[model samples]
Each structure stands twice: as structure tokens, then as C-alpha cells.
Target: MKIFNTQTKRKEEFVPLEGKRVKMYVCGPTVYGDAHLGHARAAVAFDLIRRFLEHEGFHVSFVQNFTDVDDKIINKATEEKTSIGEVARRYALSYLQDMVALHVRRADFYPLATETLPVMQDVIQKLIAKGHAYVGDRGDVYFDTESFPAYGKLSKRPKQEMESLGAQDKGLSEKKNLKDFALWKTRETKNEVGWDSPWGYGRPGWHIECSAMNLHYLGESIDIHGGGQDLIFPHHENEVAQCEALTGKPFAKYWLHNGFVNINHAKMSKSLGNFFTIRELLKQFTGDQLRLFLLTSQYRKPIEFSLDILREKLPLNQRIEAALEYLERNLQVAGLTPTLLYNEAYRGDYGFAATSTTDETEATAEENTRKSLVASREKFLQALRDDLNTPMALAELMNLVKIIQAWNKPPEVKSPSPSIVTIKFTFIILREILDIFGLYPRDSGNLHPAVTHLEKFIDAKLQERTQARKKKDFKKSDAIREELNKIGVEIQDFPNKSTWNWRK
Candidate 1:
């Protein structure tokens, strides 16, 4: 598998650092607010990466951190007359709920900034002892950016150039240089929650939490580290300096950053009044449709979200939804005996793999058509290997849908014979492929407990009407049916029993 390594600034074949046990870390949502569509893109993009790696038989340990302690979370807490922990807890849960709604699997471990205070402090003290960090005049710890050579290697921006040119936080005091950011910040107000550190009672800086958390969890050299590209500056750059200067180990093997998410080509921000939360957008599209729209663009490029484009994404989602409903319904109603393990006759070795951990081998003539389908899969996966090219991957899915639509409806479609296995693999294999894409069928007939209750109520009323009719109580039977019809549930009294269906 090829993965784009940000450290090398190119797409390279992915060889796991520790022999196929991929240790991946992604920067997760800040707990101050609800997750947005931009968050959805990053979350799902990495989710796809994890899903595909596991599909290829790799044991991947994906870790994502929750920045629960930050200026934003503290500020939000103050605004709501609540504790910072409350602010963090409330939205962290909300973010997880939104992720579940969007079909993003939970990370293997979710480390929080507040919970890792000791870890952060340990890292800060090490940096201080190493002469790479120092206590500022007013009880704050700052990283000495000038002390670390190759400081700008990741960002390619010289620290000297950014000295005065760099910016500092509001009310945040200047360190020795503007480029030197806070490793530990003092709590100015009494209400703010902070820890008693060697410098003072304060909290860790924004960048330091990730550096400390990652160092504690994934160790110095991690297989992958990812976040939005906008964070490449003071945030990620400082993290590199803080860790490398302390541990003297490569901070991360690969640095993967996602591009911006614009709203109709306009930048989305709270200041601009254009930011929409993921929960808010959920009202607009189903989880699957939103995933499709988010993946339509490559992660390295900006995604411009607009209603007009979103409307276009619906048709693609509809196809998946239609198929999902069909598959689930068939599973429910079709009582076919389960088949035993057998070698598939499909030839191309493309599409969805048939059930069985059989060895991948040459496909037959029928498998050949499936192999043609493999072209699309190969192209799709190549796009991913090349820096997670989601747009290219989506294009492949579009091509697959086209093939499914154009497929010849044989009288009775069956698995291909051994000689023809490759030819017949497309349909089945594509389902599995799409499933990894999080676009496979979902049970459409599922309803709330209330809907089931309503159905049962209608059924009871229908039964009563059927019994009345059987007794020749014409008036009672008519009244009973009329009562059910008023509630928009239609009943058909068949010879065997009373049948009911929801009103269209």
C-alpha cells in the first residue's frame, strides 16, 4: 500500500515501521464545540485509511486525542457559567455522537489533554532541563524555538524570519521571542482550572498537549501523525521541536495534513459567521450521503460545501441506500440455506471477495470481467496510496455504480464457476469494496420503538375487524376498519388473516 508521507512530501509505498503493526495517530476534535463538516472530512479520511489497512490484513492501532483543555474550552466554560471539565465533557460526547451518526469508528484510544497533565508537565520539565525551554518572567514556560536547528524543516519557514513577523495570543505575554510559544501558561483568573507546576499553577499550551500525549502513548517515533494543514505553523512545528529536542528521536515517521474546508470557496470561520457544525449539517443529509460528499474531494485540496453541490451528492447516496435496503430485506425474507466454503470461480480477483480465507489465485474467464472491474479498484486504491486521493477513489466508486446499473440481468445470477470466477467477481467484490468505503447498504426498514408500537396497534385493530367480519357483525367490522383507516394505516383482510401495511 502506498501512503503519502508528508515528511518526504511525496506519495511512497507504505511499509509499516514495526512490520505491519501500524501505529497511527490522528489529531481529533477540540472539545469546545460540535464537530463540523471539515472535521467530518478529516475523521472519515483517516477512517478510510484504517479500514483499508485492516482489509489488507494489517493490525492497526489508531489513536486520536481529544484536546479537552484549551483556551477555547476554558472560554466556553466561562461563557456558560460552567466548569471547563463540563464544557469538555458535554461537547466531547456530542462529537462522538456525531461521529457515530457519520459512521466513523471510535479510535482505539482517546487520550484527553486534561487527563494527561502529568505527562505534559514531564515533557515540559525535560525541555526546560535540556535548555530548549525556560520559565518566563511572569510564571509561564516557553519553548526556545531558536535553540532547535531544523526547526522550520517541516514548515520550511525560518524562525528568524518569523521572529517579529510571528504573532502571539491575546493577553499572552511575549517570551524571549515572538516565535517562542508557551509550553505552560499561567491561569490569570481564579475561576480557571489549572495545575500547580514548577513554574506556577497553570495549564499546558495547545501544542504541548499533543506532543506530550503522543510521546506518552505512541512513543517518540509514530507511524503516522495527521491533522488539518492550517495547523502546520506554530502548532505542529512547535510539537516537532518540543519532542525531538527532548527525546532526540524522530517525532513522527509520516506527517499527513488535510487541506482546508471552504464554504462555497469562501473560508469558513466563527469570525466570518460561516461555520456550520456537524450536528447542524446532519439535519441536511443522512450520515452516508454526507460521507460521500465529504470524500468527493481529495483531503489535500479544499472542499467547497454548498447546497447546490450537496444536492448532487444525494443521487450517489441514493444508489447505496437503495442497494443496502435491498440486501438487508433479502437477508430478512430469503431463507436460502447457507453455502459451505468453496473456491470461487470468479477470475479477475476484483470487486468483493467471496466469503472464505482462500488464497488469492488466478481468476478464470468469467473472473476476467471481474478483473476489468479490478482496474477501477486498483485505480481507486492507487489514489489512496498516493496521499489518500479521495476524489480519485470516489471516481472509482462512480464507475462501479455505472457498471452495476449496466450489468446484464441473467435469469438466475449465481457465483461464477472455477473457470469463470474472475468474470463474476465484480458484483460481489464491489459490494465489499464499497462497504469499506462506508457506502454499503444499511437496513432501511429499521424504525423507532414507537413506529413498531404503532404497527402493533394497527395490527390489533385489524384483528378485531377481521373477527367482527367473521361473526357477520358488519357494523362493528366497518367501524373497526374505519378507525384504523383514520390513523393512515391500511388493512387488507385476506382469507388466511388480516394484513396491514403503513400508508404511503
Candidate 2:
């Protein structure tokens, strides 16, 4: 397997430090605010990576960290007149809820920065002994970027260019280099939250916490390290520098970056004054819809998330979902052999031809067109291998679903040999792939939440109208419909049955 490593700016074979075992460390959310759409993209991107790796039969251990201690947490805590841990804990819990709702698998470890201070200090001590960092007069410690010649390699920026950019010295001793970053700041009342350290009482820097957690949890080298592209510059780069400088080993074998879910061609950031939290957005749309929309584009490309597209794209998904559900329902009703797993042998390689034949003899070749199944399956796998090319994989999956629809539908067709092993092979493969992509299993196998609530309200309205009609009031039925219409629900009358779709 190969992945595009940001450090090399090219695709490289993915060989884990341990044979057949993949370890991934994702830079997790800061936990100061509700996770936004950008956060959603990163999470989904890495989630796909883990899913695909597991699909390919590799054991994966994924760990993501929580930055419980930060300026934002402190400020939010102060504003709410609560403890900092309370603020962090509330938001962290919310993030976990949101992640679970989105079907994101729980990581092997989710460490908090505050919980790993001792490990962080140990790493800091190594840097100090190596002369890569030093204690300042004010008792703060700073990483001397000049000490690491490869400091800016990951970001492809020159030291001269960085200095020319006029970055702040950030309140360190005069003896410290201007470009040096703080490892710890001297304890002071002004710095709301401080932890006791060798130099003084201070918390971990944003970048250091991840390195410490990554090394402690996954060790010096791992299979993959992923996060939003925004962290490429100082955060990931510094993590590379600090971890490698201490351990004398590559921090991560493959560095994966998820492109931004851009707004107006600009990266979404708090400083940019344009941030959309995923938790809040999920309130408006289902998690499946959000995951599908995010996966509609390749993970490496930027996504222009717009309201109109979201509206348009969702129903398209609904249509495909509706079609797949139709197949699943009919398949179950037909009582086809309930097999343990789908088997894929003797299936056609791929394409529409695999599922079609104009000649009677060819049609009676005793097959479900092995070629078509192979083609579709190959395309799906290729897309997955190509940096988890979800959109392409999605297109192929939908196409396969259509083919299945065409074959399994009305026209009395010749059934293939029931004993053919490949017949079930194709079926199981598609189902398995779809499951990993989070596009299968249809509605909750019950009424949707929106539908359930709408039904309850409609039932009440119908009872009210039934009473009104008993009193010979035609106006009341029409009035009830109007009331439902105002709240985004619609009713359609049928000869024997009634149903509803969302109202505009």
C-alpha cells in the first residue's frame, strides 16, 4: 500500500514499523469549542483510512488526543465562571457524542494533554539535554529552531522566509532566539492555568502535547499520522522536529493530510471569522448525509460546502439509498439462501457487459456476469487505494447497485446455478464494501426520528380533525393541514393509505 506523504510531496509505500500492524495518530480536536465542519472533514478522512485498512485486513490501532488545556478553554471557563476542566470536559463530551453519532469509530486511546504532563516533561527533558531547548531566566523553556537544520522541511519553508514574516517572539527571555517557541512559560497568576514543571509551573505548548502523546502511545515511528492541512506548518512540523530530535527516529512513516472543507475558497478557521461546527450542523442533517457529502469529493481535494449543494446532494443520496433499500427488501422477501458471507468467484471482471448479454447462449452461460462484478469491485478498490478515493468508489458502488437493480427486477430472467459459489461472492463483497463506506443498512430498520416525531404530531392532528368532522366541520380538516404545513410537514391523502415527504 502507498500513501501521499506530505513530507516527501509524493506517494510512498506504506510499510509499518511492525509487520502487518498499522498504527495511526490523528491530531484531535482542541476541545474548547464544538467541533466544526473542518474538524468533521479531518475525522472522516482518517476514519476512512482506518476503515479501508481494516477492510484490507490490516490490524490498525488509532489514537487521537484531546487538548483539554488551552487558552480557549481557559477563556471559556472564565466566561462561564466554571473550572477549566469543567469547560473542557463538557465540550469534550459533546465532541465524543458528535463523533459517535457520525459513526466514527472510537480510537484505541484518546489521551488528554492535561493527563500526559509527566510524559511531556520527560520528552522536554531529552530536548534540554540535547541542547535543542533551554530554560530561560523567567523559568520558561524555548525550542531553538536554529538547532534543528530540518526544522522547516515538512512545511517546505526556509528559515530566512519564516523570520522575514515577522513572527512574534512570544514573551521569552531576551537571550532566546526570536524564532524559538515556548515549551513552557514561567508560572504566573496572569496565566490562568499553570502546571508545576521542572522550570516552573506551566502547561504544555499546543504542538508538544501531540508529540508527547504520539510517542508515548504509538511509539517513535508509526504507520500514519493525519490531521487537517491547517496544521502542516508549525504544529505537525514542530511535532516532527521535536519527536525525531529526541528519539532519533522518524516520527511517522506516512503523514496524511485531509484537504479543507473550504468556505468561499478560504480555509475555515476561528481567526478567519468563518467557522461552522459539525455538532451544530448535524442538528440540521443526518450523520449519514454529512458523511456522504464529505466523501462525495476525494479526501485530498478541497470541498466547497454550500447550502444549495447540500440540499441537492442529499436527495440524490436518498434516491440511491432508496434503490438499495428496495433491493435489500426484495432480496429478503425472496428468501434467497442466507449465507454466512458473500463469495465472489466466476463473476465477470467488470462493466455493464458483465451483467448483460444480447445472445441467448451468452445469457444462458450460467453466470451473473463475473466480468461486471470484477470491474465494479476493482474500480471500488482502486479508488480506495488512491488515497481513499471515496467519490470514485461511490460512483462505482452506485453503478453496481443499478446493475443489481436491473438484473434483479421484473422481467422473468434465467436464474444462475444456485450452487455457483461466485453468485454469493459478488453479493457479499458489495455489501461489505458499502458497509465500510457507511452507505448501507438503510434507515434505522424503523421509522426515522423526524418521521416518528412527525407521525406523532400528525396522529394528534388527525384525532383532533376526527372529532371536528364528527361535529360536521370540513373547515377543521383543511385547517389541520395548514397547521402541519407551517411547521415543515405535509400530508397527502390516498384512497386507502397516506404518507408524507418533507415539505419545502
Candidate 3:
């Protein structure tokens, strides 16, 4: 598989450091407020990479940390007149809830900054002892930028440029070097949120939390380290310096960063005042709908957001959902068992579980369908393998849906052949691919409450309309049709019967 490494600025082959075991660490939310689209985008992007890794037969130990101790969290606590722990726990739980709603798998470890204090302090001690960091005059410990000759390598910015920028900012005036960043920020009193360290009472700096967590959880070196592109500069670069400085090894084999989410031609951020909370969008759209819309663009490119575009993508998601329901319902009616595996259970190449005769020997229709199914699955995997090109992968999924819809088009045939069973199982394999994408339909059967209710109402109305037509009450029949139309229902008439579906 290939992944675009932000540090190298190129697509590179992914080979885990420890055989087939992959250790992936992603920067998670700060947990000061509710998660927005920006958070969801990064979460979904890395989740896709994690899922793909698992699908490729890798044991992925993914850790996404929560920055439970931050200036924002502290400020929020002061504003709410509550403890920092309360504030952190509130938003952290909110973030986990949003992840669940979005179908993002929970990370193997969700270490909090407050809980990882010991490790953070230990890392800082090593840096200070090795002369890579020093205590500032004000009691804060700042990293010694001059000590690490490769300080700017990951960010590709010259020390001169960083020095120039730091000169303008009043915050760096106290540090020995302009590029020096805090390893620990001292608190004035014991009442504040801090721990007793060798350098006095202070909290871990923003970047140090990740470095400490990565070291404690995944060891000194890991396969992949990922976050949003915004963190590429000081955040990730500093992590590289601290981690490699302490362990004298590569921090991570590959660095991955996802692109931003734009709103009104500007990046959507919590500080920007143009962000939409994931909770707000969930009111009108399902988690899968939101997820599908986010994946419409490639992970490394920004996606423009608007309700119109989101609604337009609704049918694409619905098409996939409708196909699954149609195939499952039809197969069950034909007394055929639809065997499928969950996303985690899928080990790749399990899609062809149902044996079939030679394609040339099968009927022409079945032969063509089987070829399309096999081709679509291959295309889907190929797209994902190519740097996780989700748009291309989604197109392949749509093609699978089209093939299923075409084969099952009706005048409902009930004489289930072995070919049909093979096609159904193949479709289930395609569904496994969707699961890897984290797009699972809520109802794969005919038991969706809203859908079942609508069916009963529509069926009753259709019956009433039929009686009206038989009684020569043409006006009443027309009125009934108009009523259904107002409710976004359309009916297609046939010689023996009629069928109904939501109007496009």
C-alpha cells in the first residue's frame, strides 16, 4: 500500500517497522468544546487509513490521544466555575459520542494529558539532562533549539526564518533562542492544574503531551504519526525533535496529515467562528451521510461545504443503502442465506467465498454480472491502495450498486439460481469494502421503522385508489394520486399492479 507522507512530500510504500504489526498515532481533539467538521474530517481520514491497514492483514495498534489539559480547557473551566477535570471530561465524552455516531472505531488507547503527566515529566527530564532543554528564568522549561541541529528538518523552514517570525511574536522573548518552544509551562501556585516536576510545578507543553504519549504507548519509534496539516509545522516538527532527541532513533517511519475543511472559501476552524458542530449536522443527516460527503474529496485536498452539496450527496449514500436492502430482501425471499462479515472480520479476498462455474459456461447475463462484480471489487481495492483515493473508491462502490440494481430489475423473479446466489454473495463482499470505508447502512432489511410505516400507509392509499377506480370515481383516484405526490411519493402503474417509491 502507498501513503502520502507529509514529511517527504511524496507517496511512499508503507512497510511497518515490526513485521506486520503497525503502530499508528494520530493527534486527536483538545476537548475544549464540541467537535466540528474539521475534527470529523481528520478523524474520518485517519480512520480510513487504520481500517485499510487492518483490511490488508496488519495488526494496527492505533492510539489517538485527547488533550484534556490545555489553556482552552482551563479557561472553559474558569468560565463555567468548574474544575478543569470536569470541563475536560465533558468535551472529551462529547467527542467520543460524535465519533461513535460517525462510525469511527475507537482508538486502542485514548491517553489523556492529565493522566500521562508522569511520562511527560520523564521525557522532559531526559531532554534537560542531555542539555536539549533548559529551565527558563521564569521557571518554565524551554527546548534548546540550537542543541538539535536538525530542528527545522521536518518543517523544512530555515532557523533564520523561524527566528525572524519569532522576533515579531512577544511570547518568545524570554527563551534563549527564538525557535525554542516550551517543554513545560510553570504555574504560579499549587492550586493550578500542574504536577510537581524536577523543574518545579508546571504542566506539559502542547507538543510534549503527544511526544510523551507516543513514547509510553507505542515505544520510542512508530510506523506512522498523523494529524491535520495545520499541525505540520511547530506541533509535529517539535514532536520529531523531542522524540528523536531522547531515543536517538527515527520518530516515525511516515508522517501523514489530512487537509482542511473549507466553508465559504475559508478554512473551517473553531477559532474562525464559521464552523458547524457535528451535533448540529446530525440533526438533519445520518452519520453515514455526513461521512460520505466528507469522503467525496480526497483526504489530502480541502473540501468545500454547504447544505446544497451535502443534500446532493444524499442520493449517492441512499443508492448504496437501497441496493443493500434490495439485495438482502430479495435473497431472503428466495430462501438464500446472505453470508457477510463485519468490517473487522474481513481479511481480504474473502469476497469470492461462493464458488461458481466457469464464466463461459454460465448464462450470458449471469456471466456478465459476475465479471462486473469481480472487476468492481478489484477497482475498489486498487483505488484505496493508491493513497486512499476515496472518490475513486466511492465511484467503484456506485458501479457495484448499478450492477446489482440492473441484475435485480423487476418483474420480480423468484426462481433463485445458483448464479443469483453467487452474485448476492459477491455483493456482500462489496459491502465488506463499504464497511472498511465506515459506511454501514442502518437498515439492511425491510424493518426500518420509518420505511415500514411509509410502506403501510402507501399500500393502504394505493388500495383505496384502486377501489375508487373500480367504482368509476376517477376524481377520487386523481385526488389520491395528488395526495401521494405532495408527500414525495410516486406510483408507477402496471397492467396487473402498481409499485411505489420515493420521488427523486
lDDT of each: 0.73, 0.75, 0.83
Model 3 stretches with alpha carbons more than 4 Å out: 164-173, 337-361, 412-418, 443-504
- What residue runs in model 1 are displaced by over 4 Å at the alpha carbon? 170-174, 323-368, 408-424, 443-504
Residue-by-residue lDDT tens digits, candidate 1, 1-504: 776766677777777779878888888878887677778888988888888888677888889999998778778778866678877886787788777777778898999988899999998898889999988777788899789977877877765666755563545555777778888888776556888888878888889988988888888888888888877776788888898999898888888888777986886755567887777776666677777788888777888988788898788877755543433334334442111111242323433554332444543443455555777877877766676677778788777656554442353674223322332344445565675687634522222234457778877787788788889999998898788766545777677787876343
Could you say which candidate leads in lDDT? 3
lDDT of 3 by residue, 311-379 (tens): 999999888887887777666777766553333334344444433555655656565566667788889
Residue 362 CA displacement from its true place in model 1, Å: 19
Q: Candidate 1 deviates by what RMSD?
A: 11.2
Q: Estimate the TM-score of every prediction.
A: 0.78, 0.80, 0.83
Residues 1-504 of candidate 2: C-alpha lDDT, one tens digit per residue: 568899899987777788889999999988777778888888888988998888777899999999999888888888866678877776777688677656678899999999999999998998999989998888878887888888888889777765654266556565455557777766576455888888877777788899999889988888889988878877888898898888888788888899998888998876687987775676677777778889998888999987677777787567566555554454455565423323322222222334344556655553545556667888988888877878889998887766655555555763433222333445665666666786544532222354456668787886676667668697987797788766545678665444554342
Which portions of model 2 show Cα errors greater than 4 Å?
A: 164-166, 336-368, 407-426, 441-504
Q: Which 10 successive residues of model 1 have the least lDDT summed?
A: 336-345
Instruction: Return whichever of 1 and 2 wins on TM-score.
Output: 2
- The best candidate in terms of TM-score: 3
Arranged by TM-score with the best first, the candidates are 3, 2, 1
User: For all the candidates, what are their Cα RMSDs to the real structure?
Assistant: 11.2, 9.6, 13.0
